[model samples]
Target: MAVILRYVDNKSQVIERFMGVQYVIETTSSKLKESIDEFLKLHDLSYSNLRGQGYDGTSNMRALVALAKKNSDIGAFFTMTNSLVNVVGCSCKRRDALRDKQQENLMKAIENDCLETGQGLNQEISLKRAGDTRWNSHYDALISLITTFSSVVDMFDMIVEDCYNDSAELDDCFAEGNTELLICLARLSPNDSFVAFDKEKLVFLAQMYPKDFTDQDRSALQDQLDIYIHFVCSDNDFSQLRGINELAKKMVDKGLHRTFAYVYLLV
Candidate 1:
C-alpha cells in the first residue's frame, strides 16, 4: 500500500496549479491514493509542482516514488523511512495467523448449523456450525480486510463522520475554479500557506550537523549539516527543517556564510 499527499502551496488556487507543481506528502502505501487523487481532482488541483515525496519503508512505494520523482516535475529530494514497525508488525505474520484461526472457527460454526436447524442463528449449535461456515467465513474475511488496511479504514471513518466539510469548502472553490493546472498551482503556493521550522531544534540540528566531526568543531558542524541535508536526512528533513533566521544566525556565527546555498537547498 502506498499513500501520497500532494502538498498545495496553501496560497495557490486549484486551477492555476499544475499536475506536478506541488509539494507532496507521501506514506508507505497506495491504499490512500485513490481517495487522495479523487479529493484533489474533484477540487481541480494538479500535481505539477510536487517538490517532495514522503513515505515509510516499502519496496512498492519506493519503486513507484523513485519513478515519479525521476519522471515528474517533483523535486529531487525524497523522504522515506526504513520501516514503520507498528504498522508492519500488525499486518505481517500475526495478522495472517489470526485470519487462519478465524476461518477455522467459522468452519466449526457451519458444521454445527447442519446438525440442527438451517444455517440461521435460530438453528442448534450443531447445525449452525454446518452451513454457518460460509457465513462465518465471509464475516471473518471482512474483518480481516479491515485489519489489513486499518490505517486507511480509520481515515475513511473520519471522512464519513466529518461529512466532508473540508471537501465542501474545496467543492465551493472547485465550482468557481478554473480547470487550468497553473491556476490550481496558484492556490496551493501562497506564502501564508507555506510551512516553516526551527533549525535550532534537534530535528533540524540533525540535518544541519556535520556527518564527520573534526577537531575544528565549526567546520565539522557545517559539513555535517550539509551532508545531512543533502544525503543523510530523509524526507523528514525537508518537511521538518526548523527556523530559517535562527539557523542562519548559527551558521553566520560559525563563519560559513552562504545565503545562496541555503536558498538553493529550499528551492
Candidate 2:
C-alpha cells in the first residue's frame, strides 16, 4: 500500500509528500488498516490526525467498467473493438498496411478539402490496444478507430477470411453509495467561484466519516463552509481557480489554510 501525506507546512503551502509504501501480506480491511497504521507510525503520524483520506484501489474503476459490461451491447462493442485491434496489430505487415492505407485516405481527404493539411494534421498512427485496467485506453482506442475507420474497413475487406480475437478497494457500501456521493462531490467543484458548492452535501460527505469528524466538527462544518464559500467566491484570486488542486494551492498561498482549517479539510 502506498501512503501519501497532504498537509499545510509552515510556509502555508499545501504539500503532498510521499510517505512510502508498505508491503502487506493480505488486503483484508483489518490487515490493510493495520499495515497503514504501522506505516504512519513509522513517520510519526496517526490516524487520529488524518483530516482527509483517499484510496486508489485497483477495483474501483475496473469494477465500474465490469458492471457496465453487463449490458450486452456495451460488452459486444468492446469485444469487437478489441478483436479489430488484435487482427490489425498481430503482424508487422498488417500494421504497415494499415498505416499506408490511412495515409492514402488522409491524402485524398486533404486534397478534397475534407481535411485540412498542417504540420501535425493527418499524422499516420496505428490502432491503440485497449486495456482492462484503464478505461481511458478504451476511449483512446475508439478515438483511433474514428481516425482510421476507412483504413480498418479496407483492410478487413482485403482479408474476408481473417480471424478475430478478444480480451477502489471500494467497499460494498462505498461502491453502492458512490452514485450519490459522486453527485455530491461534483457539487464541491471549484469552478466558477465554487458555484456548485453545496454545504449540506459537503457536510453529508464529512459526516460519512465519523472517525474523522465528531459531532462538534460536524456542527461547526456548516458555519465553516459558509465562511469558506463566501471568502473564496468574493476574492478575485480565486476567481479563475479551475479545480481542487488549484483551489488547495490558492488556499495555502493566501494563508486561508490557517483561518479555515475545517474548510480546507473538506477541500
Cα-based lDDT for every prediction = 0.39, 0.78
| TM-score per model over all chains | 0.17, 0.39
Q: Can you tell me which runs of candidate 2 are displaced by over 4 Å?
A: 1-57, 161-267
TM-score of model 2 (CA atoms):
0.39
Best-fitting candidate, scored by TM-score: 2
Write the residue-wise lDDT of candidate 2 on 1-267 in tens digits: 555577999999996654555777886888878888888888788788888765546564475457447768878998899899998888898898888888888889888989877787777777987677655576778889988999999999765644322102335556779877787777768898788988889989887688988989989888888888888788899999888889889889999887988777877
The global Cα lDDT (0 to 1) of model 2 is: 0.78
Cα error of candidate 1 at position 120, Å: 23
Mind giving the per-residue lDDT tens digits that candidate 1 earns over 152-209? 3443454465568887888878765434323323222213212222223322333433
